[model samples]
Target: MVSVEVLNNHPTGGALCAKGRAAPEIVASPRRLTVPLKRTRPRGAADPGWVEVSWDEALTEIANRLGAIRAESGAEAVAFGVTTPSGTPMVDSFEWVERFIRGFGSPNLIYSVEICGWHKDFAHALTFGRGIGFPDYDNADAIILWGHNPARTWLAQATRIADARRRGAKVVVIDPKPNGSGQQADLWLRIRPGADGALAMGAIRHLIATGSFDADFVDAWTNGSLLVDRATGRFLRADALWPDGAADVFVRLDASGSPVPCDTRYTQQSGGRLRGVLSVRARDGRMISAATAFELLVERAAPYTPARVAELTWLPIADIEAFNALLATRPRLAYHSWTGVGQHTNATAIERTIASLYALTGACDRPGGNRWPVPPPTRALNDYNILPPEQQAKALGIAELPLGPPAKGWITARDFSRAVLEGEPYRVRALVAFGTNFVVSQGHSERNKAALNALEFQVHIDMFMNPTAESADFVLPASTPWERDALKIGFEITQAAVETVQFRPRMVEPVGEVKADYEIAAALALKLGMHELFFGGDIEAGWNYQLAPLGVGVEDLRGHPEGRRFPQAFRDEKYAVTREDGTAAGFATPTRRVEIYS
Candidate 1:
């Protein structure tokens, strides 16, 4: 039984939010579907004509129909749609589903990247070549909540922020409304929406103009000193000027006005002192004037003055100046934003600007700054090579977006509807969705419904029959957490700040003919002759494989329902050290340095 007393263990200090307290009621609701139902009517029919079916019968019919569709229309006609793990834990099945789809020869995996953290991931990867890590609230002297409202969204993080404020950490909240986080902030800037990029650029200009940035870190650890060609707007490679210089090696003007290799060893030995702008001659005897990437960034940010940003964002210039002043003085500062900033059309630029500002302060991967989480030990689950090269080229959003695809051959949720309805690049005849509420969750519900109506076959696996399920040809019942045995290694919101691993056994027997999502996936894989690839229909085998690197097994977790913690300690400035191979272990990027230009 799930007791209300369990709430005490939560990070919110026994303060259970309405949703947390209502979880038991929602799980035991009468509307829960406990059996598989097959629709016998045609597409767009008024009545679904759902008929109860046995698990074996439902799996067989789905496999046969999908096989027939694939044989007739090719594998590109099929697609898979999934939502975030908070609403549905189908994220855990991502690798298995990808394996199944690739083995079946399809390249379409539609997901909620655009509406979630795709912009943040893509922007940070483009700039720092890694996902933006969570802030270290415990050690922070100051925190900026930009476009994020954690109080109502993530109670655990909000609790930590509240505790940080109690310990005298200055809090600044930048949002359009008086949100829950804003209510408790030391300074709240109610700026206009969609103006985050401008504000960030303005702040960067202020920092650069006032010499508030960490110049030492920028010169030593980033590509800020690498010279950029004025003609092509590309980094000036050393090989272009010196015949024997490496092609990947970049050049920076030394004290003698000559180009030198801009490697980390040279920067460390030179004490991070280099010319910001210089003129040089190429092998072709052409005189080229170049400026360092830092100078170029300053030039780009020059136009966004505080007054201009105030006009654009409808925020006070004084407030913007004050915020920048606070950021400049704080020794341990961190800023975070989420979906609100990621939902814009110019989200990539916005997130990149935010990351650039953060990098200027030298607050990344530090004790009291934004720290990268210690990742759980696990094998690479997504087998990228499973999909053939030809099918990968047909992904829907590649030509349009250019970036933002999670994998080389995946489509975003924004493009799924059009790809299915119009079939512009290719037709998508079938959709197998797990826990996605497309009808109400996606924009333009009518259009999403029409796209669903266009599909030749649709399968929905969920705990309840939602609008999406109502339109699906097959609605398979899914097991709840209460009726299943599961393992969770870390808290998603906290980013493993308090590292833990917990195993939850079945609290009660399953209500009816319901099965776990992985079980259904395994059963379908068996029917498709991929049982061996899926570990002979064994979910435990998959878990064990995932846990192999951690030196733990399912057997080890069987008796410990409360879970255990593995010891770990955070290290500062770890990114600048050398690797086991004796090479520099700088930020992961094309240049092996933080790329403000890219």
Candidate 2:
């Protein structure tokens, strides 16, 4: 058992949360699985006889079974499932796992996409071409906690928020239930579930109607001036107007009420120069009235008046007005949200509208507002190109749920059950899950069980034998964080205001013969004749490869258990950098600007 000790130099003053304090008991729990177990009986047997097996034997059997299934039904038949990292560190192997699967020729991988941060990630990418980063609480004068209860969910952020409030920052909380943060909030809006989109639109309408939005930032950094055809609802391309010109160039109306080719260079310095053009006559004898993307957004949000939104969201009209008032009046306002706003069917729309709040107010990428996260320098490990296009075309849910796929082409957990049970697109004959408590973590537990039972071969890697693992054909024990040496770069919960990298040395020997998740994957990769792809089964080599871009190696972290901070400076308006052609390198979107409408 590990003992807790206080250190003066610690970031949190050596403070241990309740969960952290109980780690020893949790790790030493009787329910923890210590050995690899294989089911001896057929699928769906209530009393399936279990037999112990060595790591080598288990890995070989799993590899052979998966290989046979792939040969029979093609590699697309194999699917992978993983839970979020909140419960286990197995997700740290996500990139490597995807690499292995892509090399093995499959495109289906599942995680809690819809119920987690997928909406935030995807919607923000659509609007800003990147994920919204953490709030700059230290400099913020106003905070809006939408559907996020940081007090219970993220204590670090909660503490920072509390301190911000004590220092005169107004706190507004919007949630269905009265939470820890909500109780102390200056204003609390008790919203109805799945109505966040309406509320956000309502707030946006207020901003637009009252002329409280940051017109300068919107006109400059965003696609507010880009003209969209009224008939097609698509941006009018430069080439469409000028047949001999660049097809990718978009059009914007100048101050003199004339069409101008809006290139990347023009976008940088064209703020407030062009008016919001509602329409223009096409050169092809068509009187096409084109509206700016911002104008379209205003029209879209016009219907969500405060009263109507209050009715739809079960919020008070006064509260909605007050919330918008604070946002409009506060100079340094920051908004934050998490899973509660992302679990609904309209989660994408909701997150998009929330992102627009920051853009409309010029809060994004600004000091004391929402700052983009600086990702640690790491090599791209997901060799997604290894999978052929035809195979990738078989990924489930692309037709029905377009925004559910992440950067790595993950199949949403919401659709995993359907793909497995219905086999509408194709049959999924094999599954390799890590850290996923499928029945509990996913929606429709019965469907998940049926899908698991239907699989020709199933493997589950976890520290405990949960219901999902009991249904698997092979269950491999996983090592806990205490039993593994790892590099903790930043806090996933708080987004780490001060960026630092720390080495976590193994505190104790792993229980029984359990191995780290990466080791298991490497062993299986070797059995599948893909050892070279996995750095010849060297875990340290993989770590070094990931850190090479940062000019650090695994050995550099070995002696620095306390971690080291890189001398990086945080700057506001990071997206305002200029490109080589003297145009604005505004954002990474197609229009090279923040997308008000996609």
Instruction: Please give the CA lDDT of all the candidate structures.
Output: 0.78, 0.78
Q: TM-score for each prediction?
A: 0.94, 0.94
TM-score of 2: 0.94
Residue runs of model 1 more than 4 Å from their true location after superposition: 7-18, 264-275, 388-390, 406-409, 493-499, 580-582
lDDT of 2 by residue, 1-598 (tens): 6665544343443345556667788678788888999999997787879899998889988999999988998987899887676535754666666778788888888876667877666777888988867788888989989888887776667877888999999998888878688998999899999898898898888888888888888878888788888888888888777766577888877776577787754545464332365556565877787877887888889999888998899988889888889877847887788888887777888888888877889988887888876766667667678788888777877777655673355887656777788876777888898778888777788888888888878899998888888889999998877888776555442334245667678888888988887788778888999978888988788878877877988788889777766545556787877567766657888888888888
Instruction: For candidate 1, give the lDDT of residue 236.
Output: 87
What value does the lDDT take at residue 469 in candidate 2? 87
